[model samples]
Target: MSLERTAVRQRAEAVLRRLAGDQARLREDQWRAIEALVIDRRRVLCVQRTGWGKSAVYFVATALLRERDAAAQRDAAAQRDAAGPAGPTVIVSPLLALMRNQVDAAARAGIRARTINSANLDEWDEITAEIHAGTVDVLLISPERLNNPDFRDGVLPKLAATTGLLVVDEAHCVSDWGHDFRPDYRRLRTFLGKLPERTPVLATTATANARVTQDVAEQLGTEPAAPAAPRPDVLVLRGSLDRESLRLGVLDLPSPAHRLGWLADHLDRLPGSGIIYTLTVAAATETAEFLRSRGWAVAAYTGQAEDADRRAAEQDLLDNKIKALVATSALGMGFDKPDLGFVVHLGAPPSPIAYYQQVGRAGRAVEHAEVLLLPGAEDAAIWRYFASLAFPPEEQVRAVLAVLRTDRPLSTQALEPLVDLRRARLELMLKVLDVDGAVRRVRGGWLATGEPWLYDGARLRRVAAARATEQQAMIEYAATAGCRMRYLRECLDDAEAVDCGRCDRCAEALFTPEVSPTALTVAQTFLGRPGVQIAPKKLWPTGLESVGVPLKGRIAPTEQALPGRAVGRLSDLGWGGRLRGLVGEGTPDGEVPDEVAAAVIEVLKAWAHGDDRWPSRPAGVVAVDSRSHPMLVGSLAERIATVGRLPLLGRVSSAGSAGADGPRGNSAQRVRTLHGTLTVPESLAGALAGLAGPVLLVDDLVDSGWTMTMAARELRRAGAQAVLPLALALAA
Candidate 1:
C-alpha cells in the first residue's frame, strides 16, 4: 500500500478507537456503508436519528480526503518546481453551533480548520484565501453563506478548481420532505453540477426518511454509495410531556398579562438561562420587556432585530449575561447552550417539525431540563393566524412571477408595490425561485431567467401529499390518547415506543377509560357531516344529559366563538344603517328607550364601507362579507383582508377594534358634525401634492364611504383630487 494511504488508514483507525473507547462505536451497517463509500469512489448520504454517529462517518472521511489531497500536492510538486495549493475538503453546515463544535473537535485532534459564517465573513474570506494558497486544511461554512453569490462565484470556484471534496452536514435540509427545509440547499445542485465529475460528495443528517433520502440524492445529483439500512438503535428516549418541575399549565388569560405573569414567575427562579419562543417579533420584544420589568437581564431576538443587536444578544446568551431570551424561530437554529434549563413556548408552532426543532434546543447536556408548551385556545388561534401568512395567496405568487417575467433587474423598492410580501419573506421566496431556476439575480436585483411556468399537476400532487402528512401529524398531536412523546416519535418515524413513565397518560392511565360507544358513534357521525355546523352539545343522547359534559361542551371556544358570532352579528348590525330599521329610532312617547337607541346606533355604526376601515371588523368578517356582499368583492376584499391577515397585525392587541368614533367605543376625539371644513389647508395641499409632509383631515369614520367622500371633496376643492388617506383604524 502507498505510504499516504497507510497514514489515512491509521488516522481512521484512531478515530474508531477513540469513539469506541467512549462506547460509541459504529454499527456493522455503518462501517460497511463507509467502506463502500471509499471503495466505489462514489458519493454517500447517511441519514440517522439524533445521538447516532452520523458525524463520525464524515469526520473519518474528511481525514482520509485530507491525507489523499496532501499526497497529491507532493506528487504535483515533484513534477513541478514547488508544492501546489492544498485543496482541503469543504463542509457545508446549516448551524454555526455545529460548525464551532466541529472546529473545536478538529483543534483537539491537531487538525487545522476554520469556520466561515455571518459571524466572521472577513475572517472566512482570509482563511479561504489561505486554503487556496495551501495553508488551511479544512473549511466549514454555513449553507446560507455558501449560497451567497460572492462566495459561490468567488471562493467556491477556487475550491472546486482544486478538485475539493464537498461534505454537507445536516443534509436533510436539501429535501422538501425534511423537517427543516431550506431554499438555499436547492442551489447546491447547481454548485455540484459545476464540480468535476469525480469529485465525491458526502452528506450526513440526523433525521431523514425514505422520501428525504431520495430528495437528498436528487439534489446532490448522485446515487447512494450503498443501500439504506433500517433505523439505528441509539437508545431513543420518549421523555415525559408532563414536566413536573416546570409547573406546566395552560393560561387562557389575555396575552400581555399572562406573558408578564410568566416572566415574573420564572425570571428569578432559573439559572439565568431560559428561552421564551414567541410567534412574532413584536411578541418577542414585548415579552423581553415584561421579563426586564421583573428585574431580570433579558434580550429579544427576531427577524426585525438589527444584525448587530442580534449578535449582541447571542453573545450575551453565550456569556451568561442575559438570563433569559425572548425570540422567534429565527434565533434558535444555530445557538447552543447546554446548561439552559428551560424553554417556554409562548404559542403553538404551525407544524410538529417546527415544534420539534424549537423545543429540541433544550436539554443538550442530558440534564433534567424543562419545556413548557403553554397553549390555550388562543394559541391555536395564533397558529392559524400565522399559517395564513406563511402560505401566500395564489394571486401573490402569480404577481411575483409576473414581476420576475419582466426580464429586468427588479429592485426591492420597485417590487414592493407588486406583492404583499415582507422584505425578509420576499427575499427568501426570491431565493427559492432563483434556486429553482425560475429567476436569476442580476447586478442590482432580480430578473426572469427561466420559462414562464404554472404549477404542474405533479408538483401540485406532491404539495397536497406533503400538506396531508403535516395535517395528519397535527391531528395526532391534538387528539391522540397516549404519551405525547410516543405520539411524536411514531408520527416522525414509526419506531417502537418506549414507555415514558412520566407522561400524562402513562403516569395516571388517564386515557385508558373506555369512551362511551354511543358518544363515539355520535361523534363519528357528526364529524362526517358535510356542511352542517354540529354543536358538541347536540352529540349527547336526550337521556344522557345527567353525565355532565365539561366546560359546556365547548371545543376550542376562543378560536371558534368570534367567527361563529360575527356572521350573524354583522348582518344584524346593518350594511350602513339598513338593520336600524328593525328597531324603531324613538319610543312611543317620542323619547327613545336607552336599549333601543343603543341597538339602533350600533347597527348603523358597525357597517364598514371602505378599504382602510375593514380591519376594524372581527377576524374572518371580511371574508364572510366578501362572500355575502352584493358587489363583486374580487381583489378588493383580498387586499383589505390581506392587511388584517398580516401575522403581526393579527397578533396585535387592538386587532378588530373600531376607530375612535365607532359604536363599540365613543370617539376619543370629538367628531366634526359639519363636513365642509379644511382643518389644515397647507398640510392638506402638501398631502394632495404627494409631498413629504403629514396632514390632518376630519371625518366621522375612516370607513369606505365617509373618509373617501370627505378626502375627495377637500382635495377636489384644492384642485388636487388624487390624494391617499391614512388612518389608525376604521369603522366597519
Candidate 2:
C-alpha cells in the first residue's frame, strides 16, 4: 500500500478529533503507532501510561484502514482485482467494563462497534453476522472468547483470514511474568498465528515493565508456522510510565479498624468520587458497609457479584453518584474514569505493578488525585492465599492427563472427582494444558490431544520466584522513605523516574495519619460484631456416583442439617487474623483460646437473640471430632454446652483418615472421602434419640461442609429433630 504522509497525517488527525472531541489531537507517539499499523502494516506493542491515548492509535488506525479499503472498492481501475470492504477490526479486550467504554468511545468516532462477551451471549450470532457482512468496523471480545469451542471452530478461521487489524487490550496479561497474568490470554497465540499474514496487530498495556513488554512483543512477532522462530521485526513504542496526575503516599496504620476509621474520617477530603481497594471480597463488603454507616454512599464490587449489580455499581461510580466503589481486583483492568479523585487501598496489593495499574485508575484527567496505601499485617497472608492457587504440581497435572481419554471428552465437573484440584483451579490448569497441546477443549468438554507435553517446572519456578520478588518490591514500596512516584516508575523500568515533589514524602504530608476517636470507636464496634451464616448444602455434587458415592440429587429435607453459624469467616476483616492464627494451614492444634471462645459465645448469643434467630433453642451440643484439632473442637463444644446449660452430647466418631481436617480436593472427592467416615456412636445415638429440639453440631472449621452434612445425616437417622452446625471459622 502507498500513502502520502501529509494525507495520512490529516486523516489520522480527523479521526482523533472525532474520537476525542474537536480540541483533541494525537501525540507524536500515538501518531507513530497509527502510521506503523495503517501505513507500514506492522505489528506494534505500545507500552504507555494510562490515559496516554493508546486506544486513539487503534481507533485512528481502524478508521484509516477501513476508509482506504472503501476507497479501493470505489476505484476498481486502481487494481486488477478490487478487494471488498475490509473485515472488522477484531479487538480481544480483557474486561467487560473496558469493552463497554470502548464501544461507547468507538461510537463517538462514527465507528460501528459491537462486543461479544459473557454479558451479551444472545447478541453474539447477530454480531458475528454483522462482522461477516462488513457492516461492523470494530468488534471487541473477551480473550476467553477466543478459545470458545463454537467460536474457535466456526467463526474464528474466517475472521482471522479477513481481519484488517487485531488489537489486544491490556496485553500485559499475555505474559506469565506480568502481575495479572491470565491463562485465557495465552490462547491469543493461536489466534495471532491464524491471523492474515499482513494483518496489523496492536498490543497495548500501561502496567508492563520492560520485561513484560519484550515478552508480549515477542508473542506478537512470532510467525504462525514456527513459534520457535526468531522474533520478527515488531514496532515497539514504550513511553514514560509516569502518571503526572497521581500523588502517591503510604500511611502506616495500627490495625484494620484504624484503617477503616481513617477512611471514614477522611474520604470526603481526598477528592471527587474514586475507589477503595480491598484485598478480599469479604473486606470489600465489610468496608463498604462500614462506610455507608458513616453516611458515605458506597457499594461493594466483586467478581462474585451479579452482573446487574456490578453494572449498577460501576455506573454509580462513573456517574459520581456514590462516593467510591469498595472493590477487589475485579475492578482493575477495564475501568476508565477521567477525573477520579482518589484511590485508597485498605491493604497493599501483592505487587508494585498491580498497585500502579490500580492507582492509575485515579488522576487520569484531573490535575491531582490522591493515591494512598494503608499496609496491613494481613496483606502477606492474603498474598500467600492467592499464591497457593498457582499452577498445580507436576503429579496433579500428570494425573489429569492420565484420566483423559483420547477419543472422548470429559466435563470439568466429571473430572473434578478424578483430580485433586478445585473447579476453578482445574479449569485454569486445563486451559493452560490445552495451550500446551496436552489437551483440547471441544463441544462436550476437554479431551487429551495425545501429544507429548513437557511440564515446565523450571519456568513455573521462575514465575513463582518472580512473584516473590514482586511481593518484596511491594513491601519495599510501602516502606520506602523516598519519592513514591519515582519509586513506582523505576519499578516499571521507566527512564523518567524523577521525583514529582507531590507525594506525602516528597512534599509535606497532605493527609493526617490520625483517626478520630468517634470514627475509631464505630469501626471497632462494626468490625467486632460477627456471625456468618453457613447455608447447608442442598444437593450432592454431580458425579458423586462415579466417585463411588451413591448420593446424588437433593438431600432429603428430613436428613439435611439446618442453616448453621460461624463466628466469622477466616477472610473477615475483624476476626480473620485471630481465627487464622488458630486454624490456618500449618497452625498446631490446641485447646480453644479464651478470645476465640468468647467470640464463639458472642456469635451464639447473637444467633439466639438477634433477628432471624434460630427457629428453636438447641437441646444438646454435639462435637464433630476433628483429627487435626481435637482439643479445640472438644473444648469449644464443652464450653458452649456449659454456657448454654445444655447437655454435652457424645462426639461424632471418625472411622479413618477420610474424616481428617483440611480440604479434600473438590466437592465430589470430599464427599466420597466423608461418605462413610462419619458415624454416630452408640452413646451419641442414644443422646440424639432423647433430644426434643435441634442439636448444635460443632466443628473447628467448615470448608466443604461435607463432613458436617454426613454427620448431620447420621444424627438425623439417630432421631435428632434437627442438626444445627456451628463452627469457629468459615473458610473462604
Candidate 3:
C-alpha cells in the first residue's frame, strides 16, 4: 500500500478501536467504504444486514474526513478556497431512538455529537451554533426534520453547503418501494441536490430488497433538477442479508385468545430480554397490560407514547430492567440492544421486509436468540386497515390542490372542510405536495406554488399493487413449510439464502405450541372483558361553518352527548374480530347476534356498576336510526332495555335527515352530512318529555363520534333529559 493509504488505514483503525473496543478492527468491506468516502469522496449505498457495523463505516470516515479538512483549513492555498473547517457530519436518521443511539455511540469515540428532533425543539439553536462553530463532530436529525419549515428555509442551506459527510440511516425509507416509505424521506432528494459537489454521502439500511436497493441507489446518484443528471459511479455494496443467531419459528394458535395465552405461558421461556411486537398500538397496549396482569415485567411502546416514556422504556430494555417491551412498529427501527435475546411478533407484519427489519433487532450480539411469530387470524384485517391509509385517490388529491390559494396560505384546519381527508392523511398529502413543488409550507401554513402538478394515478396504483403483493408475500412467509430464515432472506432477494437447519421446518418444532389450560382460561377472560369508554367530543370540529354547519369551537355542554360506553373497540384483541365481522363495511343489516347481545348486556351491567357509571340509570332506551345497520342497532337497543327492564321509549327517528345513507369524509364533513338528518317524531317527543331521566342511545358503532353527538343533540332537543351513547363497537 502507498504511504498515504497506510496512514488512512491506521487512522481508520484507531477510530474503530475507540468506537467499538480495543480489539476492534475494520472489516474489508468497512475499510473499502471508508477509503471511498475519505479518499475518493464518492456517494455510497450499503445494503447489509443489521449488526454488520454500518454505523462504524460512517463514524470512522467522519473522523478521517474531519481531520483532513482541519489540516486543509490550516494550509494557505486550501484556506483561500474554503472559509472554515467543513462542518459536522449530518446523519438523517428515521427514528428518535435511532438518533439517540447514534449520538451516544459518537460520544464513545470522543466525538462531540448532538441531535435535533421533535422532542428537543428547545435545543436546535444551541446545536446549530455548535455545528457552525466547528465544535460538533456528528449531528443527528430525523428524516422529518428535513421538512421542518424553519429548518428547511433557514439552517439547511448553510448546513448543506459545508457538511463533511451526509449519512442517510435506514435509507430504504427514501424509496417509495420500501416497506416503510415516508414522504418526508423523499425530501432527501432535494437536500441531496443542495449539497456541494464532492461531498461524500453514505446511505445505510438493513432491510432493502433488490428493488428498494435500486430505487434508493438511483435517488442517491441523481441530482433533482429540471433535467436530472445521473451520476452512474455511485458505489453500491450489497451483502448477504442473513442473521445466523436468529432461530426463526412460527407457532400458529387457534385464535386471538389462544395466541395471548401462548404468550403468557411461554414468554418466560424465551431466551432473554427482548421485544414483543404487535401490529397496532391498541394491541401493544393490551398485550402489555395482559402480560403485566400475569406478573411479567413488561411495558407498552408505540408511536402514541410520549417521548419521555418511549425513551424511558428504551432505556429500561437496554439496561435489562424489563423482560420485554410490548410494541408496535414504532419500536421497529434504530433501537440498539446488542444482547436482545428474542423477538416475538403477536401478529404478522404486512411486509416480509418489514418483519425482517423488526426481528433483526434481536440476536444481534448473542450466539443464540429466539425469534418467533404468533400469526393471528386478524392479521390480514389489521393489515387491510393500515393499507387503507395509503395515498389518497386522484380526486381527493386534486381537491387538496384545488383549495390552495396562491394569494394566501391555508392552515390544515382551514383546508379540512374544503377537502375530504383526515387530519393525519391531509398533512401527509401536503408534505408530498410540498416536496413535489405543488405547495410550499410557509410560517403561517401552506401556500400554493402555482406550479403545474399532474396527478400520478398510474404510479399510485402501481404502488398500491406493490403493497398488496407484499402483503401476500408476508402471508406466504407465515405459512411456508420451509426454513423460515431462508424464506425471509429470499423475500429480500438475497441470492445466498439457504435452508437453515435451525428453523422449525428444517429441524423440529422447537416450541410446544400449546397453551396451558389455566393460561388459556385467563386469557379468554381478559379478552372477553368488554367496555371501552367513549369520551364525548367536547368541541365541534373546526371549520364546521365552512362545511355548512352553523357551529364552531366547543359544542354546547347542554347539547353534547354524555360520556358513553361500547362493548369493545373494533381493534380489541378479544372482541375486535367478531365486531369487525358484524359491523364493519359490507355486512348486511340484521338482528343482533346472540353473542353480541350478551356482550352489550355485559357492558351495560359493568357501566352501571363501575365507578364512572352514569349519574343515574337511563330511564329509557333509544336507538339511533342507523341506515347501514338499522336492525342491529334496533335489536341491540331492545336487548339493553329488556335486560335492564328500562322503558323502551322509542327510536330517534331519521325522518327529516337529508344526506347520504352513510356519511363519509372527515369530522367536519361528516358532521355536515349528519347535521339536520335526524329528528324525533311527535310521539317519541311526548314519550321523551314524559320520561324524567337520560336515555341510552344505541348505534352499531361509534367512529368519529359525530353521529352519536348529532343523534344525542336531537334527543336532548326532543326533551330527553340527557343522551348517553352505547355502541356495539368503537372504531379505532
Candidate 4:
C-alpha cells in the first residue's frame, strides 16, 4: 500500500477507537465501507440492524476525508486548489430526535456537528455561517428542508456542490417499498445530481428488504451530469437483520381493556425502562394515563408532543426514571438508548417491516429484552385511515399545477381555494410534486414548472397493494403458530429465517392470556369514566368566501356550538375501542345499542351531576336528522330525553345539505356541504319557544364537526339557549 494509504488506515483506526473506546475493533463490513469511501472514493449503501455501528461508518469516513482535505490545504504551495472548506459532510436525517441523538453522539468523537431543522430555526444562520467558514465538520438536515424555497434554491445547491461526504440516514425512505417512504427523501435525487463527481456518499438504514436495498443503492450515485466522474459501482454491505437479544412474543387479548389491564399488572415485572408503542396519539395518551393511574412512572409522547417535553421524556427514559414512554412512531428511529430493556406494542403496525423497525429498538445493547405485541382488533381500521392519506389522485395533482402555472408564485394558503385538499395532505402532495419537478417552492410559495409530470398511477397502486399484503403479513405474524422471530425475519426478506427457540410460539407462549379481575376492574372504570370535550370551531376556514361562500375569518361565537362531549374517542384504547366497533367506517349505520345508550347516560349524568357539572341542565333533547344514521340519532335523543325526564324537541331536517363526496377532499368541502344543511322544524321552533336552558343536540357520532356546527347555528337562530353536542364517539 502507498504511504498515504498507510497513514489513513492508522487515522481511521484511531478515530474508531476514540468513538467506541480502545477495545473496539472494526468489523469486515465497516472496514470495506470506509476503504471504499476513503481510497476508492465510491458511494456505499449499508443495510444493517440497529446498534450495528452504521453511524460509525459515516463518522469515521467523514473524519478521514476532513483530515486529508486539511493536510492538502496545509500543503497549499503544492495544491492550492484543494485548500477550500473541504466541503462539510452534509447528512440528510429524517427526524429531530434522531438528529439530536446523532449530533450528541458525534460530539463524543471530537466531531463538530450541527443541525439545520425546524426545531433550531433560530440557530440556523449561525450554523450556516459556521459551515461556510469550514468550522463545522458535519451538518445534519431533515429531508423536508431540501424542498424549502430558500433552502433549495439558495442554500442546497451550494452545499451539494461542495459536500465532501453526503449521508442519507434512514435511507429506506427513498424507496416506495420501504415501510417509511417519505416523498421529501426523493429530493435526494436532485441533490445527488448536483454533487460533483467522487463525493463518496453513504446511505444507511436499519429497516429495508432486498428490493428497497437495490433501489437505495441505485440512488447512492449521481445523475449523469458529470461525465468526468461517472458514477462508480455502489458498494453494498448488508448484515444479518436478526438480533439475538430480543425474545419476541405475541399475546392475543380479548379486548382493549384487558390489554390495558395486562400492562397495568405486568409492566413492573419487565426488565428495564423502555417504550410502549401505540398506533395513534390518542392511544399513547390513553395508555400513559392508565399506566400512571396504576402508579407507574410513565409519560405520553407523540408527533404532536412539545419538543421540550419530548427531550425531557427522552432524558427520563435514559436515566431510567420513567418506566416507559407511551409513544407513537415519533420515538422509534435514531433514539439511542443502548440498555433499553423492553418494547411492547399495544397495536400492531400495518407493515411487518414497520413492526421490525419498532421492535428493533429494544434488545439492541442488552443481553436480553422482552418484546411483545398485544395486537388490537382495530389495527386494520387505523391502517386504512393512514392509507387514505396516501398521494392524491391525478386530477388533484393537475389542479395544484394549474393554480401555480403563472410567473407569480402562490403560497399553500392561497392555493387552498384553488385546489380541494386539506392543508397537511396538500403540502405533502406538493412535496412529492416538487420532487417530480412539477412545481417549485420559492420565496412566495410555489410555482409551476410547466414540466410534464407523469402521475405514475401504477406505482402508487402497487405501493398500496404492497401495504395491504404487509398488513396481512403482520396479522399472520401475530397469529402464526410457528416461530415469532422467524416470521418477522421472513417478512423483512432477511436471509436468516430459521426458527429460534426464543419466541412465544417456540417457548409455548410466555405471557399469560388472562388479566386479573382487579386490574380489569380498574382499567374498565378508568376507560368508562368518559366526557371527551369537543372544542367548538372558533374560526371560519380561510378562502371560504373566495370559494363562493359568504363567511370568512373568526366564526361568530354565537354561531359556534358550545363545547360538547362524547362518551369516547374512536382512537382511545379503552371504551374507544368498543365505540370503534359501533360507529367505525363501513360499519352499517344503525340505532345505538342498549349498552351504548347506558354508557351515554353515564357520560351525560357525569356532565350534569359530577363536580364539573354542565353550565346548565339541558332543558330538552333534540335530534339532528341523519341521512345515513337516522335510527341511531333518533334513538339516541329519545333515550336521553326518556332518562333525563326532559321533553323531546323535534329534529332538524337535513334537507339543506348538498355535495359530492369529492372523495379524499379538503376540509373546505366538508364545511361547504353542511353550510345550509340544518333547518328547524316548526314543531322544533314551538318546542324551543318555552325552553329555558341549553338543548342537547344529539348525533350518532362527530367527525370533522361541521354537521354539529351548522346544527348548533340553526338551533340558536330558532332561539335555543345553547347547543351541546352529544355522541357515542368522536372520530380522531
Best by lDDT: 2
Backbone clashes for every candidate come to 6, 0, 1, 0
- Report RMSD (Å) for each prediction in the order shown: 16.6, 1.8, 2.1, 2.2
Report the lDDT tens digits of candidate 3 across residue range 1-732: 789889999999999999999999888888888988888778899999999999999999988888877887788697676423378899999888888888888888888889888888899899888888989898898877887889988889889888888999999999888998888998888888877777788999999999999999989886633244446368988889889898999988888889889988988889889999998888998899999999999999999989999989999999999999999999988899999999999999989999999999998889989999999888888888888777788888887887886588888988877788888888888988998999998877898888999888898888889999999998898889888899999989999999888988888877978999999999999999988998898888787776677888888888889999988878889889888888898888899989889888888888888989889988999888777787888888888888899888777767444312332567877777777778887888999988978999988888878888888888888888899888888888
Q: Write the per-residue lDDT of candidate 1 for residues 1-732, one digit (tens) a residue.
A: 667445545667676655434544556545544553443345667655443455566666666656656676568654353222246767887766567767766665456778778878568657867887776666887767755667767777777655455778777788767767777877677666555544566777655555666677666653222235222112111222322232222233333344456446544544447788877664566567655655778898887777777768877886779887788878655366656766777766656656655666665554455555654334444443344333344576667788777756876644654555655557767777777677777666788776655645466457556755675575456555666666555545535545455555455421222234443443333222211111111111111122221212322321121111111111111111222222112212122233333332232233344232222333221111111111222222333334445211110011122122222111111112112232324543443453222121212223223323333334434434222222212322
Model 4 C-alpha lDDT per residue in residues 188-266, reported as the tens digit of each score: 9888887777778889998898889998988775553476755578989888887899999988898878989999888
TM-score, predicted candidate 3 vs. hidden true structure: 0.97
What is the total number of backbone clashes in candidate 2? 0
Query: How many residue-pair clashes does candidate 1 contain?
Result: 6
Instruction: Give the TM-score comparing model 2 with the true structure, all chains together.
Output: 0.98
Which candidate, 2 or 3, would have the higher TM-score against the true structure? 2
Q: Write the per-residue lDDT of candidate 2 for residues 1-732, one digit (tens) a residue.
A: 345877899989998888898999889999889988887778899999999988888999999999988887677775444332278899998889899999999999989999888888899889889888889999998888888899889988898888889999999999999998888899888887876556788999999998999899889976853445444579999899878788888999999999999999998798999999999999999999999999999999999999789999999999989999999999998799998999999999999999999998998889999999999999999999899888999999999999996577899988887888889789889989988888999998999988989999999999999999999999999889999899999999998789988998889988878999999999999999879999998998888887678888999999999999998889999989989988887789888988888988899888989887999999999998888888889999999999999999889899877556576588888887788788888988887786789999999888888888888998998899999999988987
TM-score of 1: 0.62
Candidate closer to the true structure by TM-score (higher is better), 1 or 4? 4
Tell me the RMSD of model 3 versus the true structure.
Answer: 2.1
Against the hidden reference, what TM-scores do the models get? 0.62, 0.98, 0.97, 0.96
Candidate maximizing TM-score: 2
- Model 4: number of clashes? 0
Error of 3 at 241 (Å): 1.0
In terms of lDDT, the poorest run of 10 residues in model 2 is 76-85
